[model samples]
Target: DEPGLRVKLAEGPQKFYIGVDPTGPSLHIGHLVPIYASAHLQKAGHQPIILMGGGTARIGDPSGKTELRQMISYAQIDKNIASQKPQISKLIDFDNTNALLANNADWLAPLNYIDFLRDIGRHFSVNRMLTFEAYKQRLEKGLSFIEFNYQLLQSYDFLELYRREGCILQIGGDDQWGNIVAGMELIRRVESAETYGLTFPLVTRSDGKKMGKTEKGALFLDSSLTSVYDFYQYWRNVPDADVERFFLTFTFLSVEECRALGAAEGSDINKSKERLAYEVTALLHGEKEAVKAREGAKAAFSGGGDKSGIPSEKIGKAELEAGINILDLFSRTSLCSSKSEARRLVLQGGARVNDVKIEDAEALIGMADAVDGELMLKAGKKRFFRIELTD
Candidate 1:
């Protein structure tokens, strides 16, 4: 926070906002920090405005992008907004009168181009705009005129929200700092009002990999996009060095508890990781799903506890009786996306069926491989899949 923000916050309950563009249909784990921050603030008696960038999403945010973002249809953007609300609502209470869900399209879609240029466009200086890190980086890769205008539109969002909703602060990732400051400047210039901006650090693991990123892709909040079990496992497998920071950043646990849990050593750290996974998963999915996922992980890893949580696919009993190649069987489940990938996994000694390492890609899997009408397939040490035999 800027120096004045502390004093401003002390002044009484002030409304703060965070803007999200519906660029994708699902909210990834990357989106959770600010949402959790908003929830924390709202719990402390401040109002929260969750601005849905329906209009600006059309232009797309150029910040943190190396190339022009692919444009999606307005229908898709709207669908994305709808998809995101429930995920956000898991933390932010939409039922509260003080919480607002705003769409920038409501005002921006009806604007007259010339009028906007005369009113809002005249305030931004191109030379200064280019100096912002977002544009400076984009300039090397060719910044589009549409992308260049994003900061201005985003600034207008702050100004408009201030006028209508009395919102005075913006929160987002540190990558959004330039835009957030631009909005603060715009609010100061246009309304002669002092507004604030706060940004959360870009979270990463101790190994320097991005937080919530998996070999599969981003850890999406939508179970269909990233399965609930996989989501649980991602946190469950977080590097020991990351446990404390992630607990403080991602969960509502107290500082002392997070520190103590993060300090766990050797085998004890695994329990801390499991608790972290359960807490985070419960926050996103329901507690029931988190328990199931935990049990599924335990079952898959140790062969004890509920096996129902493991990801499974059904195949005919006749198919297994007829026999399928090891590579082909792996390709059939989420364990592998294609036969070529399965071949690579098998050749690398990462493939297993019924707890036995599969050394040959061409090895045939028959009904003999089934244990209790199911085949437990393992990829590497962590990935597991259950293939169920059906009549």
Candidate 2:
């Protein structure tokens, strides 16, 4: 049995199970703590059941919310589940293990409204349910009946898993403690079986902001939603104050190893952050992709002094023949937000043409400006765009 498994099974032997909601197609860094915890439990020779809350997602959980979430369509939910499979596979070993992937929709979707009321809904106490943080907040802010049933559905999912898979434990973030306990209670009432709930602390930034989100947006595990380079950079830029907590919750690094990395301090702290980024990225993506992402980051930051260290994009010939306005070109290529921003950048000498600063806001980039059938536009010190002069 796994070391951590002994703790979950302290009183007696119990099967471990964990769950994640497919609220979104990609798992963000915020979801990493529970994911890593589940993976740890799996390695400890306990069963891991990854529950995709397809049914529950339609009636979004009110946990940690100021308002109810917009309901997503079934088609969209299916699409999200399809996209999530690859990312989930990267962390958990799916081969020849007692691991199972289940969708709550399998059971929840088929239940008639009347049957659900009699079979599952009757077990939940209205007064106690209202006491849950998620439900209480919703009621204070005027929650809908649809959202109220979310916990019941989630609890039913837990009961079903407990009966079908012999899953004796459910784990999630601190926010899900009420829901987890609700499931445990339901199992006791309905089947006279005792179940357990364990939750990890919610991962957050040093500044008290939620993890996996930056000024840009949520740092998604899916490379398509967020580029691998940006994903790696997000982890690499964790504040020194939060690095140790991140390592403890996000990586499989032992307590001693995490302590050593945390104690590095000052300039040496970046090395630990880099290793964190690389390992975290490699765990989600592959090592090769992480290496490429790091290379891409180095190339973008190394400046013109080292052209080989920069990531390059290509443009076409006819576009240059049409005489593209430098501002318009920059905006079209996503180098700047708008033509005005591009013009301001040019006037401020922040815009560069083929590594040469362009001081003229009205600069006309024609075929004459094309170098090797391409015009490399640099916005600020980091962003690069290649304008291909077609025909």
Per-model RMSD to reference: 1.2, 3.9
Instruction: Compose the digit string of candidate 2's lDDT tens values, residues 354-376.
Output: 78777877777877776666677
Model 1 agreement with the true structure over 239-353: per-residue lDDT tens digits: 9999999899889999999999999999999999999999999999999999999999989988788988988889999999999999889987878889999999999999989
Q: Which stretches of candidate 1 lie over 4 Å from their true place?
A: none
- TM-score of candidate 2 on Cα atoms, chains taken together: 0.85
